[model samples]
Target: MQFFAPLVALVYLVAGAESACTGPNARTTPPPGAIVVDATGAYRGSFKTVSEGVAKLSTATGDSTLFLMPGIYKEKVTVPPLKGKLIVQGYTCDTTSYSANQVTITRAMAQNDIPASITKNRNDYTTTLLLKSSNVKVYNLNVANTAGNVGQAIAMKIDGANYGIYACKLTGYQDTLYANQGPALFAKSYINGAVDFIFGCTRRLGLSHATLVDFQKWHKVFFCTRKCFAQMLKQMKHILVTSVTQT
Candidate 1:
């Protein structure tokens, strides 16, 4: 009886350790009614790509959430205009920061890759994640464009209002994050690039505990804007702005 008691205690301890890693915000599992995306094929009946998961949301009514499993998804995702709010979250054991993020959406597309005659703005065409929907939130995923230091390549282009980007990493070589239109909040995230990395025309942008890094000689952190208002929290390091053209 005494030997069996130790085994019972060990089982409970193992169970407790597993439960400790899960929480409301931890996001180890998908939320109720969330569209699940698993690129690794481990989850049956789940969408195989991020794009497919987002496409499901286009026809979905009310607020929708897309939860991605832990894997590197090599694809570009675009969030089209929707009536309700949209949440795109990656699997993580710690939601408070992006360090524990297990999912990444990566693609390589440059401005020159798209034909100039097709669109007036080539920046919109080169983005890895293009958001055209309002009231959207992205959390705990690394969004990157691996287009190298060749011309203009965008990691993300957000043309949405009332959006929140939390605990994620956005990286590229040039023209990384295009905050084209926004009354948006970027919190606890990392943005890295070189040459007009965080360019935008956002009217109001809030940066709270976010890190921005530029790695090139021509270090122009920000570019064009129309009456831009930036709220930098105390935790934010200096924002090196060499040029800001008001339009």
Candidate 2:
């Protein structure tokens, strides 16, 4: 009973609590100069690397922003439920100016498994963004996997509750975005996949105002599990799937 009380309390507190953070080198505050990550959210500090900032959030579960300084912060990250409310922002990343941001959150997940079975699951390995934490929000950032095409490499994989992913883009080749067993709502977000991509077999995924952009040098969207794709199409409308493409 005592343990139950603490777990219940944590869940309630997390649901109501709002944590916010920006990259390490985010903009400074004005007037009072209270440095903040976003408009209402406040900025915590400058993390030389994303791991440092993520560690801070893992320690502090409240609304806090970890402003990442403009640089190429390369590492893998996992967002546990204990740590919530993270806002990672950065400067423009392009080929021209080196000042651009190149934060690659890597995971050992492979890229080429026709069947894509439990044996080939990268959950066994470290990942960039492991959304085990519920009621979390990630904004204004780019998550990439530089592990060259070999097996089933995944970008953003979520298996939690009430996720808010906005104004951000996830780039990868195969199995890029995996939303497992979670009721997710993805808006104004861009997802690029190759085969059986965006594969959330069990989760009740609600994707509106989203872009399912695919760059399949061979085929745009292919379903390896034929029976599964047929099941998804049974409930979803062809027009609704096409509407996602418009975004």
Candidate 3:
């Protein structure tokens, strides 16, 4: 849970990202070799579904970028191991922060959905977005598992190396983000969960200038970070915590 200032600054580039989204679900045509997933089919060379776009790029050999239009995409997305880097961009009104993020990836599945016969950790099976490709970068997106506060439901699971998440929001009730392994950098983002929202045995995690929402109300509950975790507030960037009681 350590926040690296230099790494956070270097990972996110906000020079001209505001132009990425001109209107709701409106995006320019992606250049050659690039993939754009639009909910309204507003952009040329765009796939109507996120799964279709990701499936097509998972087999390619070179670098590619996936642009997601502003919409509530109710689907599970998995980026498999690929040869080149894959960049996913969520359309936002303002690219410099998360206040204007309109793209959301949501799924409703919990540990209860799995059979008890399986002897593995139930959290792994509740992930909505699974990232297994190296050198993957995601920006200004919101991922959520709407399985209520009943059980473990992971919003995003990162199993890739050299992954960077910028200005994104991850939400769930329990086991929100399972940073299984590899070094990951999450900057200017928001993560919310009730129990063990951030867990796993990762080598290193750099969470800088991010807001962590604690939906469960309990006094003096400090979560665990397997190998190492650090809290940092560089330039007076606070880890905004909001405590909510769920009935």
Candidate 4:
């Protein structure tokens, strides 16, 4: 069974995904490009928590539709070695649509300190996504942690996973958008954060056909048409990101 199992979990991770075990009938078939969070064999409706849906699958890799019901989920989550063309989606209705909250894959430290996995990876200068596989995708979800009462934290953290983040909104206070590692693509997404939120934060990162915004007053928009500051101090190989437009 392990051989036939997905090499990774295509969690449609908004920068996260996890693997666990459950009943056979519980493997819900999420809609194409939708992330799942329910165990009804179909990606629809709400579950008690996000874990309820994730725990049902042995491995969450490959093209999947993971839909999450709108609610304030007070839980800490982690997508351990999750990979593939995954799409994490949120269940939204004009009536039940919520604006903000926190959903973390990292163990919170001080609301500002990245997260346990991030801290460990960064401190050790390791890979960002902590990916054990590839072709992973994420969208329409927030993945972060405010463990130490820091404040509104990151929305999506694509540490080191190959994927895409499309048509989503990420809200937080500090280090909001952590592309710590990304040989991936991010398009048409709303990322909110303060204090150099998305600067010198990731490597080998690619931002193509995407609309990026940094609300922080001090944060600069490095929307150059080339490889941005390739290193921590290289100063945007071409130009720097410093522009914004409201629609």
Candidate 5:
């Protein structure tokens, strides 16, 4: 059964290739009032890093948006608690899928990177993108933890509720996505990992038209929903493959 899981998932992916998210369409320019981030310094007055743009929103009172220009951001980003809704949009040519995503936020951090003395959840420390705010929506970005074959490297860790992750790609080797708490929705996204990548304790989670590929040998545990009381809605069109040839 485990050997056939990947094939089953691939069939789902092929069947749902035309499905699209209900979120906003892809845009070439930043939306009005959005904070622009251009790593190449091409956009005048734009922040050079995602963290810098997020930092600017530390004291924001109303809805905020961060528009990341096309580039690879080699830094970890943390979205702190915000007073209102937040949207992080990345440059993409196609809005329907993550295949044409032009922006990638990557880091190579793992659980071993943290100091031994820290007693807090080390999983939070290994994430490339950490969300600590509610009412957050992320779109069209490739978020990766390049800590290859390392123990417990997280691509994205959501500690807040009401998150909507759309049209993005999340890649890692272990524990790729840590949905610590959620009433969250992941739509039109691709999540790739090897072991227990989608583990979470979220109460209500939805995977709509998404594909999850675990490209390593089958482990005893996959999707570790620990004491979660979860309402996991794996839509009929969603894909969950146990293995794939890593390129």
Candidate 6:
């Protein structure tokens, strides 16, 4: 009962945060002075690509935000370790769920496609977004690796501390979302994959009100090694896997 109280409180808090982050009442537009990336150039001084906007940010820019317009951004994005907090916000109509995510960072990189000179490992070759910066929050975005079950394709690779993902969608075949090293809070999100989708040596991971989908028809799903599970239970202080629906 003692442990259950705090757990319940945490779940309620996550639910409240989710409600606040989405819906018609929520703040639809990006915060003022945010680096805007719009494909159509509808917003003034907006970059055409996500990479271009990220390049403009620096250590001097305190508490920066990247606001993405509604479009499919087909490019490999890496948010290199930064100084202050960085918030990447995606434009969405129904911000309450991942189904309405308008911004997609997608790529078609597979093990067979990557050159031998780059990396032999399938994980390194198939990453769409590599976020190494601490104190980063990504909201209402869809990150996907469209290799179509070819090999190990990663939608996003998260490494660092104090990361949070809210109302987002991560989709791939194998090894979809990699929490390499960090303590991350994933709330109100949907993750879809076939094999070993959410496998990593992450220090701590908190999942609340999330949907984990196995898209492999009649094939085995949820592949995590015993060593990794043991590590997660031993090394991590608080590893919450609550309200997760497998579909």
Q: Which is the leading candidate under lDDT?
A: 5
Per-candidate TM equals: 0.83, 0.59, 0.79, 0.53, 0.83, 0.79
Per-residue error (Å), model 4, residue 31? 2.5
| lDDT tens digits by residue: candidate 3, 1-247 | 2478766665564534545556554333354667788899878777888888898785657788998887899998888898988888887766667777878999999988889997775666788999988889998899999998778788999988998899999988888888887678888898888887877757466777778778775321234542244431222245566787755
Clashing pairs in 3: 1-229, 1-230, 2-230
Model 1 error, position 204 (Å): 0.9
Off by over 4 Å in 3: 1-32, 58-61, 117-122, 217-227, 230-238
Best by TM-score: 5
CA lDDT, every model vs. true structure: 0.82, 0.52, 0.77, 0.44, 0.83, 0.80
Q: Residue 171 CA error for candidate 3 (Å)?
A: 0.8
Q: Write the per-residue lDDT of candidate 5 for residues 85-144, one digit (tens) a residue.
A: 999989875777889898999999987888999879778788899999999999899999
Ranking by lDDT: 5, 1, 6, 3, 2, 4
lDDT of 6 by residue, 134-167 (tens): 9999999999998977777888989889989999
Q: Give candidate 2 regions above 4 Å deviation.
A: 1-45, 58-61, 89-121, 124-126, 217-247
Score residue 126 of candidate 6 by CA lDDT: 78
Residue range 1-247, candidate 1, lDDT tens digits: 9879999999999999778778766887888889999987788668999999988895546999999999998898889999999999899988888788889999999977888687776777788999999999999989999997888999988897898999998988788988888877888888888778888757567777777776754336767643342332322344432322322
Q: lDDT at 237 for candidate 3?
A: 45
- What lDDT tens digits, residue by residue, belong to model 4 across residues 6-53? 544433332242222123312223455443554233434445556565
Clashes of each: 0, 23, 3, 34, 0, 0
Q: Tell me each candidate's RMSD, in Å, in order.
A: 5.9, 16.0, 11.6, 14.1, 11.3, 11.9
C-alpha displacement of 13 in model 2, angstroms? Answer: 47
Prediction 3 TM-score vs. true: 0.79
Lowest lDDT sum, 10 consecutive residues, model 2, at 31-40
lDDT of 5 at 165: 93
Query: Of the candidates numbered 3 and 5, which has the greater lDDT value?
Result: 5
